[model samples]
Target chain A: MLNLNNLLLQVIRLLLTFVIIFLTLIIFGVSPFDVFESILYGSLGSYSKFIRTLIVWTPLCLSALALIYTFSAGMWNIGIEGQIIMGAVGATFVARSFLGDDLISPYLQILMAMFFGGFWGLICAILKIKGKVHEIFSGLGLDFVASGIVIYLIIGPWKRAGIASTSGTDIFHKASWVPTVGDSNFPIFLIILVLFLYIFSLIIFRYTSLGIRLKATGINTFATNRFNFSSEKYIVFSFLIAGAIAGIAGFSQSSGAYHKLVPSVSGGFGFLSILIVLICSRNIYFTFIVSFLFAALIVGGSQLQIKLGLDHSLIGIIQATFVLSWLVLQKIEIEKITYKQISKMFAK
Target chain B: MILLENTLVTVISLSTPLIIAVIGETISEKGGVINLSAEGTIMICALFGFIGAYETDFAVVGFLCAMVLGAGISFFISYCDINLRMDQIAVGFVLTILCINLSNFLGQDYVRINGPLITKFSIPFLSDIPFFGSVLFNHSLITYLSIVLIPLSWLFLNKTSYGLAIRASGENPSSASSRGINVKRMRLLSCVMGGSLLGLAGASFSLYTKYGWSEGHTTNYGWIVLAIVIFGGWNPFRAAVGAYSFGLLQVLAIKAQSVTLALSQILPLLPFPLMIFILIFIQYINRDEIKNVPKWIVAILGGNQPQSLGKKLPEEIK
Candidate 1:
């Protein structure tokens, strides 16, 4: 029954978002029918387009999965963006080294990316636990610093042949690149690896004692102490896991899609994943479906830029509308409860 | 002497918008609400303020429009926070991203377009006072208003009855409600007022300091303003000082570029990490676990954040 209600709520939120998007289209002087038709055709019209959608879907899905762990542990992890960047930086460092020696393995670079991303994530978690700083502020501050670090590297030390452009570092050698299927940008093995991880997470979330303890820590930190569970350890553990997953997402983007470390390599995928996770309400299955749809939105939104001269950022507006409306709907549901009932709920 | 005077003038001019923004955020936080949407709000307002002035050719109209937009966004945040009992941080974060993207999409046509700037007005007698005249007496009207806002906000927050109500609402809403203070309404009013000031700050950016709108313009300043509020301990006077100091650092970062080629680009990033360090340092010195810290050190370094700052008010109060 709860799942049914959640499904209903999701449908309502989706409808409201479409309505708002329609209105936005009108404001942009585009026809709703044409835009909708184009969006449908653009994202899934051909086999290649579907593959493109899946390519975008991969990183977004991973980021959402990462967020689920952090959100479950009651940490905002707003620095996921920074963690992703650090992952790219880690990967870039390895790839750049390979330029001098072509024999270095690609798998080691991916491992190093995860290490760097996890390290960055640990910094935010440690700041929260040890420094008594709020995760939101510390994470945000770290994000700026992380981006600054990237800019410094790209424009300062890592400039391609004494020419510093926003175009980013010199491309990695072909051997260092993630191998993709013939003429397709999708890395088939990496996609399978992520899918396996997603299944593993689902099992962990449903059947593992650690998952239960993490949820308990989120619900009531004091309750965990009574059960001899260290809430702080779980919090830190969740952040590390999330950061590793986000790091891999960053690695995939750098090695798979761009094949170079551009300043916008993350492309707001970190923030976009937060919206997807929120819409999914922390369910892994729901996250998989929603991520694909959002990926389609991104691909389709880019198509709008080509076909209708609309700004591609329209996708962000649409995503924001969906999340904002969902928040409002959740608020309306909460407002229906009486004060006495809420007090009783709190007491429990 | 001339270079120092010029640097001082630049610092004050650059600090105006930050001062106004920090004061605004301080007010809202004092009333128990956190507007994390300040970054997006500033960006959106800057774009709209530019568009309004460009079309109407009136800077005042542009400023007014920005304020109204700011207030409207704040009202939405307050509604979600107070009426729905939603998390303010989550709502504000979403709003921040939404407003930023919306502004970018809508402001594409207005980018790099020339518009009327806010006119600078020099004080009659103060303008003739040598170094001080050039440094302090000469600036846009918005800068003067920002300067006035420092003392005005301090007096209003400290001395007024409404100020007491705001503080009470933030500190202990349930008790404040029991005293017939109407905690929700006070928070709503404070949020709107604070949001208006944020709008003014945005307008000041476009009309006075930066003098035009562009993508990612006023991007990270909102987060800096947030840090400044905490650094100021939510005090208006101290917050203004924090803003001015940040402005000085920014000016120095630019000037330091000529001295070193490689570190210059990295120099500007120093304030962000420094702010984070300050946040941690303040918390470390204040934690009760650190018993070795002296009482006077605690008194000086420990910021007394409102007791129930982010708590949801009881449904009965609404």
Candidate 2:
């Protein structure tokens, strides 16, 4: 019965979030129903486009799941964005440097890319734990640095011999790229990646000692310290895990969708991961759903602008509003609890 | 002579936002609130300031409107964090993201529109002084206000009754409450006031410097200001000195670009290292000083009130 009540409250919160989003869209002169339809039709309207949307959302879902692990440790790892970029940089360097090697297997190359991405995230984690710098600002600063590196690489070493605004390295060898899973290779890999991230996150979050320690640290570091756990170590570990996962996002976007490393390869997937984690309230399972919906919105929002002459950035405004409203609503919910437990039965 | 004048002008102009924001933030921090939302406040103010000045062609109106908007934004943060007792750092961070996107959305239309820039004003005799004349005396009223406000703020905090109340609240909320001070009200007002100054700083960027709006125009000034506040050890005069020093480095970067490109780019990163060093120094300094102060003084100035103060104080006083 208590479980049911909690479930109901969560559902109400989710519904409230949707309602708030709908109202905000109305203000922007876009009908919520139209948005809903567009998203639905855009994602599933054509088989190829649906597959494309699913493919695009794969790394995004993985990154969001990775974020849950870090967030559980009570660290707002804004550095995930930088970590993802670093991961991409890592993957791009690896692919470019050794793509023609005869001894390197395709699967091994992909694995190496994944490892490189994780390593980039670990760098951020180490900096956070060792340097005693707040991850938030450091992460933002690192993003600029990473983006700068990417820009430098493109204009310098990674520049294609002759192309206008190509601004990136040559395409990866076919073997280094992740082969499509089925007749529809893109959708199949997308499905596999999403399921893998969700299941892995679910198991890790529910069944691991590190996960529990992370959660404990997130809630109260002093209490966690009382148990003799090093919150800093857990935080560092959490950041590494988050970074590695975001790195996979970078790797997947390049290997699966773009097939070449570019400045826009991740296309703000790192940032979108924040919104997904927020709306899902840090639940791994719900994050999967939110990532897909968010992916659909990105796909549809652009379509709406192209077809109807609406501002594409309206999606950003809508997403920000939803997150902001949720923050306000979350505070109100907390205020209703704890101190004095203001009764709803009292006259309004 | 021209080079010196330009360098001085650049330093003062760039320093204005950081100086104002740092000074205001010093007040906010001394009141026990670490407002990471300073970035958001400045960004939103920058956007709104551009809109106001572009629409009205009046610099003061644009600045005033920006302050009002900044105060409103900061109020939400203070309301949530202070009154509701939510996590101060988390709320401020969230507001930072929200404010940035909100300003960016609104600023899309206003970006290209140019507003009248505030021309430099010279004090009669002060302007005639040899080296200092053009460097310090020849600037807009806002720049002059910064010059006065630093010392004025220092006086207010160290000498005034209200400053005492603010310091007391920061030290111990419960004891301050016991002394008939409204801790929440003080913090809220401090945040609002700080935010307004930050807004004025933002307006000065567009109205007095760039004379046009652009997305991300605040360009991390907010974070730099926060770093400046900490670097100054939450002291207004020290913060001004910090801001001016940082401003000089920034100006030198541009002026000496022909000398060293790498150094020019890396000069901006100088503050991050300095901020970390300063934070550790202050922590060490305060740790030693923590023991010698009277319990009441500590309570009034120490961050977060002790649990004992609430029950020990007279019922009527609370």
Candidate 3:
């Protein structure tokens, strides 16, 4: 499925991205080499660090996968951030209830997260379909609305005993937390879930008409009219599925990562994944790989403060620069230009 | 009477940046480009504005720096939209993320440090007037500029030949090109102009109203400006009204804070939901079925979105 030339071009583009990031860091008085080394060693140097990277990867990858669904249907789904938040809210609702101690609480959180996330996604779809609102603006508005709901929950009815703060809700019941294996606190449950979802997504796209219809809806809204099915229905369908998947990501954040619902429960993974899918597009395998790399970057960024005395905001700068540079480079066909120049040089 | 005067003054002064920024976005949109990076542009510009003032100790330099930064960003977006054939929204979206983080990273040193503040200049005769003076006249130069900008931009866009050329390009590039207009150049010029005002608004936040630099300073204001622009329906006067209404909302929010924290937190986000509702309303009003809608209602609530807002320019006109 891969060609040497494409791989070569990809490598060249990645190197260029790194060069840009490296130069940007030097301008900020940071050593590019040291930063790279630190990030590598911090994320993958040890088993525990790698595990932390995995924790970050679960949601990052899940959101990327979720984005594929909506993107294929030509939907922006920028409200994916809000959908993730609502998913956390859904999980927190179950965890704080009479079922908090039940063994089924974690399982139930998954369903509730899906329901809540899907419902939030449905709102975006409806706004676009009936209200004729652009998904970007509607999604942006819904994101703020979701955050408002989260802040309200944290500071009002869900406030801690004798103190109300925007910090977060009480920790979810231990039983509701994503179950870990042994003394290593390995996130086996989350890993299994990721694997299952990936395989499920592969099968759905490869073997079913749903995938074809969604792609068709994305390619041309009117073209689907000749096929006798409304593209609007597929838009709604993709949004629901995307939102459901993104909700699971939120569930992972609340249960596996933080073990509680915070005001910023989404942790920006939704937005980050949007960037990832922008470059990766509908390539599922690429999404998986890119999300892992981004996860490592994020996980390792936590080390910047302690080891290098650098602020973690540098991580944001690097991620954004990498994505922006990559997008610009791809748009201009830097690889093609480079190849042309190289051949010309050889001929000369 | 004094209480009402104080409230009105606060509302007028506080709404300055929103007023300026909305007009800037309106200018950009009127040229057929949606600069979605408003949130991040204001953020980064706010930081640089504070840095420029804090370092140089001159408020004017800060405003200038932010204006350049904002204009440069819009220039980049327009350039990419025209030459590189990239999606305007995607490019703007990535820039927003990059600019916001870049500000956070670079601004770490400048956070919470007091920068130069804009001084109030009350007109001697105007300030003595009974009601309008207290509410409108006794304010800083930038605030006065914002007030003036409302009508000024309205005139420039409605009456000027340059404004007509830009509007023609936005409405239909092919037709405008046929009329001997350089569509690409007009878009670039208008985007830069709009972006500069956005930068001015960013500096206004730091140097005038919400003074001092901090991480995430001027948060949500950029998005709120976008919402208000839509609420204004592409008319400078209407957009100014939307900005002022938001300022009133913020004033009410501050007062509500003492009553309850939850309400206070929720009130600020009201613009977003209201944005959604207004958009839906606009769509409904624009529908063909609504044949008997009152002209007055259209004047007040009707939003005449740009004919080619957010769409790609078709062919280049030299």
Candidate 4:
């Protein structure tokens, strides 16, 4: 019965979302058909656009997967943004340490990125476990501090010489750049790495004792104690894993796409991944499709700017409306159940 | 003497928005709802308020528009959390991102554009009172109103029957409902009231304090306001003090930058980490294992959050 209600809610949410998007397009004085055509052309029409979608899809997929662990553990890892930033910072630090030397492998830099990102996540975990600070506040505080650190680096010490541009550090040596497919910057290796991690996580989540323990811990921390499983250890481990994956997502953004660090390297991917996770509602298969669609929306949003003179951020409105309406519909379903129950009681 | 007076003035002006925001949050939390969309709400409100004032050439109209938007957004958050049984934090976090993106998208044209500003008004008698006059009397009407709100909020939370109901709802909603307080309604009202104040704070930024609309305008102030609420132990007076001190720190960070070039860049970053440290420090001191601490020290440092905060009231109550 609950499954049926959820399915009904999902269908209603999809219809309402379309209606909202259609109305929004009308309000902007743009034809829905034209915008849809442009979006289709921009996201999947040509080879270059398809690759661009994949470039966005890679990190978004990784970040969404990273969030799965934390969300499964009943944690709000809102600090994923900070972890991603720190990961980029870590990778940059390693790349810059070579001082333009061509000896250090880019692979090593990615590893360092994961380490630093995981360390940052561990710090948030420690705050929760020891300091009793809520992860949400602690994570938020860290995000601000991390961004401040990045801005300070770009403008102060690590700034490009002579002009102090917010353009970020000089591009890492070509050796530091992740290898791409022929004639295209498509990060084939990173894509494979992300896919491997995704498959590995899927298997672990389904078949392993660790996954069961984590799920049990999340569902009832007290019950986990009764079962003699240390929920804290699982929680911390989940954060560490999530942070590392998110770190690699950050590394992918810098090394794979931009070839250098910028202040906005994460490109709000951390938050976008959260939306994807919520929309998927813990279904792994759904996560893959949603991440791809979200990536298309983002890529296509930029097209709206070029083709229709509409702000790309129109995508934000659509996405927000989707999540908000989905939530509202879920609430309505619950209200219906309760209303029916009350009416039955009155009749009796 | 001159430098101290100047710094104090800056602090007072800077803290007004925070004061308003913290009071609103305090009220909302007192009624057992945590409006975590504060950061995004403030950003959106700042943008909308600026656009309204810019279009209408009236700061008052901008503030009114902002309050309405804030209330509307708050209503949505409450409706989702209360009626839908959604996680308040999750819904709030999503709303924050949504509003932020919406503000950026919609306010693209308004960015860097000049807008109407609230004029500073000083009471004649108060303006001549030496130290107090310069420190307190020489500010705009909005700033004065925020100052007044500190005391008014405290009284409202502690004195009136409604205030008692709010506190009762936050502390023990089940009992409060049993006593016929209508906990859900109280929570809804508190959220709307708090959200309106947040809107006022956002307007204060574009219309008065920061005095401009730009992308990322009034950045991170919302988070700082949240920090101040925790630091203030969720009390209006204490939160106001925390906001003022934070403003002083920001001023000092700027001043220090002039004193030393290389270190100054890093100095501005100090407040965020320091706020986090303070949050942790408060928790540490408040631990049950701690002994030998003075009574007043414990009272001032420890924050006892509302017991029933973030929990959904049982539907059977209604």
Choose the strongest candidate by TM-score.
3
| Native contact fraction, candidates in order | 0.77, 0.15, 0.81, 0.65
Clashing pairs in 2: B168-B300, B171-B301, B171-B302, B172-B299
Alpha-carbon shift of residue A48 in model 2 (angstroms): 4.4
**Predicted candidate 2 versus true structure: per-residue lDDT over B128-226, tens digit per residue:** 988788889988888888788898888887798888887776767777888889877777777777878888888877877656788778867887887
* Per-residue lDDT over A231-295 for candidate 4, one digit per residue giving the tens place of the 0 to 100 score: 99988998899899989988888877787888888888998898889888766788888899889
Alpha-carbon deviation at B258 in model 3, angstroms: 1.4
Q: iRMS of every model, one decimal?
A: 1.6, 4.0, 0.9, 2.3
C-alpha lDDT (0 to 100) for residue A334 of candidate 1: 35
Task: Give lDDT tens digits, candidate 3, residues A48-90.
Answer: 9999999899999999999999999988878999999999999
Q: How well is candidate 3 docked (DockQ)?
A: 0.82
DockQ of 4: 0.59
Residue A256 lDDT (model 3): 89
Scoring only the A-chain of each prediction against the true A-chain gives TM-scores of: 0.90, 0.87, 0.94, 0.91
Assess the local accuracy of residue A219 in candidate 2 as a C-alpha lDDT between 0 and 100. Answer: 89
lDDT of 1 by residue, A140-175 (tens): 878878888888888877888867766788887887
Model 3, residue A30: displacement in angstroms?
A: 1.3
What TM-score, computed on C-alpha atoms, does each candidate reach?
0.93, 0.83, 0.96, 0.93
Proportion of true contacts reproduced by candidate 2: 0.15
Best by lDDT: 3
User: For each candidate, what's the DockQ?
Assistant: 0.67, 0.22, 0.82, 0.59
